[model samples]
Target: MSDVKKIATRDSYGAALVELGKEHDNVVVLDADLAAATKTCVFKKTFPERHIDCGIAEQNMIVAAAGLSTMGLVPFASSFAMFAAGRAFEQVRNSVGYPHLNVKIGATHGGISVGEDGASHQCCEDFALMRSIPGMVVLCPADDVEARAAMKAAYEHEGPVYLRFGRLAIPVFHDEENFHFEIGRGEVLRKGSDVALISTGLMTAEALAAADELAQAGIHARVINLCSIKPLDEELVLKAARECGRIVTCEEHSVIGGLGEAVCAAVAEAGVACRVKRVGVNDEFGHSGPAKEVLAQFGLDAAGIVRAAKSLLG
Candidate 1:
């Protein structure tokens, strides 16, 4: 196998914001005193007047971002996933979502991927929080190309959008021209009949690997790159559930109220029957360690995905 070329979605977000700033003068970026770590430092350096540091107050940052958006400025707020959705949820709900403000919450360091920072810094419940909001849009791009597209799309899209990304470098599966994205659409990566591996974010890559592994074992698996967690592609999900006898959902988020839960709800509502399994972070806190080790320990790695697939097969 070739060496896995990985790129962090946070890096892609930083680059995309800089490009957006250069192309559109009204695009502003705000950070909660984590410009360097969150990769908003590049934006701050490029557009000094447009970048605002809220000094560790994520809640205040959300309010300020909503205020900026209300004034017809496209504000992309930067912070860790936990702080953006976990801490500033009320501000996002009332100030941004309620008013339908065009504020982009560029949440980084999602799920167990923000290893060594421990459980507090790692946000496993962000999707659950954001999806519950009435008017908020929940998005989690699978790779660098998708991340760039999502950033650009969020700027063009109206209403409050929550874009979740990770801190660690992950395998980049999509190229610039290969795949395109829509707000509520999912992409079919591979086609098969026996089973379907549906996933989003960092776990998408792992699901792809698991599919390849299953192929070697004479099992044909279809792979679906499901980036938009909320407002999920119910039609596509149900079709997959009907076509494939077994369904497996992969995400770096928690097993509860995340991609897995979203898919399950869709399947249940659609009256689809299939052997469904979920691969992701369990209901447990994280610990400070290397990213790979943390993923393995938390059963969020490729091996975990393969195990899930095997169980579904049985």
Candidate 2:
């Protein structure tokens, strides 16, 4: 992956906004004084009139987006994940989720990937918070291609959307032209029967690498990229559980209420005879470090996925 073309999903989010802005006159962007960090500044640079800076007020920004949505404008509220999802959870739920507005929350710097930003800035519980909201669509894209495509999809989606993008530049594994993306649909990168490696966001890259390692160890693994978290692709998950009989769920977020928990609920509800293991940040706060080192320290990397898979297989 080091040799592969790397791109941060936040960068993709900003670029996608510019593209959407060009195509739709009703498209507008609002940032909580983090345009540069969240990459929404790129959209601001191109369309200054359409970009609104709420001056570090994440909750106010979310409410404003909700208001703008009523005016027939597609408003994207941009901020750090901690502020957008954690701090503004109340406003998002009451204003956007309650009304089912067509507002998009572009939450960047999600999970432990915030690295040196430390625990306060890292938002590991965003999925749980956002998923709890009725009619809220949660999406965590894997790479640059999917992030841009997700931005387009979020713009088109009728109800509220929460998109969590990463700060770290991860491997650009998917081809832009060849890949196809749909909401509530999981993409299978590799197929095997020994175990299913399920993951979302940047962890999908790690899962792909882990599948290769598992193959070397004679434990063929199936790699499923679950980008849509809330409306999870339960069919693909059930199929994997039925075929592989073992599942390893991974994410950059906490294992409690993210991809892991979603898969567990799906498998349990389907009554599949499968063993599921979760590989992610333990229910703990993150400390300051380089992004890659922090992820490895928390066992959110390829080796961690392989370890969990092997344990489940054994």
Candidate 3:
């Protein structure tokens, strides 16, 4: 609808770091030899002195970032999701999460959307891993605007934060002037009554498309962007479960401990009566292919979401 402009969330994160670097002198960036791929090169180009290249050592980068945080510097560590969240899990947990350090982890190429890189680069369990860490805040921004906002929010918030980004360029749905984003807040993009489509990251665009399709079939679907995964907006989720009898969660990550499971747990804890249908990567490894094709293959597309919603409603 918004002129179909496609921009990668990683691009937004890169631009955000440059802006933040200019505004906050204490802000520093560290990348594990993937600055270009992670898009942190933008910040490195602008503020060379403030940027550190850790050279493929994600664990060392995590430890360095934690040490920088102790010195009152806001360190944004950038890397592929597989390395940032997987290879450096122990360092992140012990050095950052344990001390509640102000280190922002910018993990790009997250989920099966990493595409041709295959399963080794694709990280579907980053959310689960990061969410398990104590005092860790996880965020999966839906689009470019949300990604920029989330980057700023991560910088402002204290303690460890994981901001997930994707390699594929997705649709931009939010207007710059009208978009309001907070650290732990969930925004409802579309209002409906029949069912609620709760989604995070790039899958939110698909959820919106699904809502449009559901409307054509006389099924009023509420579209909620659950960007904040760790400190999930439980109140909004519960409200959706109560208002809309059926709930469908869409995400690019695995359904194991991602948005899908978080939504189901919230609904259950609230004692709300609702049937939840999770549309995600069903606990499997990613394959090498086009990102869009892979998303469709894994039932993370708009049509797939519509099917899931319809199935739950039935």
Q: Lowest-lDDT window of 10 residues in candidate 3? A: 291-300
Candidate 3 segments whose C-alpha is farther than 4 A from its true place: none
**Candidate 2: worst 10 consecutive residues by lDDT?**
305-314
Per candidate, the number of residue pairs that clash is 0, 0, 0
List clashing residue pairs in candidate 3.
none
lDDT of each: 0.89, 0.93, 0.93
Could you give candidate 3's per-residue lDDT for residues 1-314 as a string of tens digits? 66899999999999999999999999999999999998989999999999999997999999999999999899999999999999999999999998899999999999999988899999999999999998899999999999998888898898899999999999998898998889779999999989999999999999999999999999999999988998999999999999998999998889998889999999998889999999988989989999888888899899999999999877
* TM-score of every model versus the real structure: 0.98, 0.99, 0.98
Number of residue pairs clashing in candidate 2, backbone atoms closer than 3 angstroms, sequence gap of 3 or more or interchain: 0
Evaluate residue 10 in candidate 3 and report its C-alpha lDDT on the 0 to 100 scale: 95
Where is model 2 more than 4 Å wrong at Cα?
none
TM-score of 3: 0.98
Clashing pairs in 1: none
How displaced is residue 230 in candidate 3, in Å? 1.4
**Candidate 2 lDDT, tens digit per residue, 1-314?**
45899999999999999999999999999998889999999999999999999997888899999999999999999999999999999999999999999999999999999999799999999998999999889999999999999998888889899999999999999998898888899999998999999999999999999989988999899999999997999999999999999999999888888889989999999899999999888888898899889999988999999989988867
